[model samples]
Target: MTDRNLRHPSPSPDATTSIAAEAEGFLLAQEHRSAAHREAQTLCDALPWLTTAQAEDLTRYYVAHRLRLSRQLFEASLARAEELRREYEARYLRLRRDLLRRHGAWASVLLACAAGVSGALSTLAR
Candidate 1:
């Protein structure tokens, strides 16, 4: 086949302007997304009952549902983020509990040592 046909494969002419316009639209959409995410984070933080997963899912739902993009990838990404957030939260809570336990144990040991030293000094004075 000819080089032109080989390169493009399809007979459609290159739509540079159209591609650029679409790219511009995508950038605008991304900016809107960032703003929306910031708003969602604020709302989520204020409303402690709402999990991050729920906020993200709401964001994705609003974007996909309102924008009407047929792209399945965004929905999939939201679901994945929800799952990852759950796992991360579980690990964080476990780590926090472990750290607190260790801290309390160490504090008790220090207190006991202090008391023992004070008792010995008092006896020496007598």
Candidate 2:
């Protein structure tokens, strides 16, 4: 291989997956946009009295509003997901610490019991 090829290498599987995900997201966004436009058109259709320009303007405004709301919802969901991740991780750490402490206490008790048993046996032998 050439030096440039060696340095760059090929895309990893993860990179490919990321690309696929991006494409999928793009397609979904496009579909959502079309759906929003159709909805706006349907609303405009209900009002037959509007001029063509007025209808077009109303549709544009409606689509923009829908897009803004969708963006806000998506961002809020991402924030909530981040919060849940942090909460779960903290709870997991707390539970793990408690489990380790419990196990340590049990081990200490078992060690003391064995020592006591050996001491009694020695005393009896003497």
Candidate 3:
């Protein structure tokens, strides 16, 4: 018979308690309870041959793996947010510069026109 078909001995009381404690620790550390539950359920579903106790222990490891993935996703999202903020700041600066240049040009034109009008009035008086 294949090794898969052999009946394994049950874990000792000490081992069971250790596993339970580790599993409980993982559950407590998770920020999202629903996510941890979902991960446990998925592990149980995938290993139908496992006893309830064995499944519980395995689920803790699975939950830890899920947490690692979540951390990586959060890091990537934070990087993207920072990149978008910088792009927006640069665009705003460019727009402000363009507006200031236009305002300066208009002010220069108005001043030149005022000077011409004053010169014409002086000549007429003379």
lDDT of each: 0.78, 0.95, 0.84
TM-score of each: 0.46, 0.81, 0.62
Best candidate according to lDDT: 2
What lDDT score goes with residue 86 in model 1?
Answer: 100
Question: 15-103 in candidate 3: lDDT tens per residue?
Answer: 99999989986775565556776868986998889998888888887777777777787689999999999999999999999999999
Cα lDDT of candidate 2 equals 0.95
Query: Model 1: residues >4 Å from true position, as ranges?
Result: 1-70
Candidate 3 global lDDT: 0.84
Tens digits of per-residue lDDT for model 2, 1-126: 999989999899999999999999899889879989999999999999999999999999999999888889989999999999999999999999999999999999999999999999999999
Worst 10 residues of 1 by lDDT: 64-73
In order, how many clashes per candidate? 0, 0, 0
lDDT of 3 at 65: 77
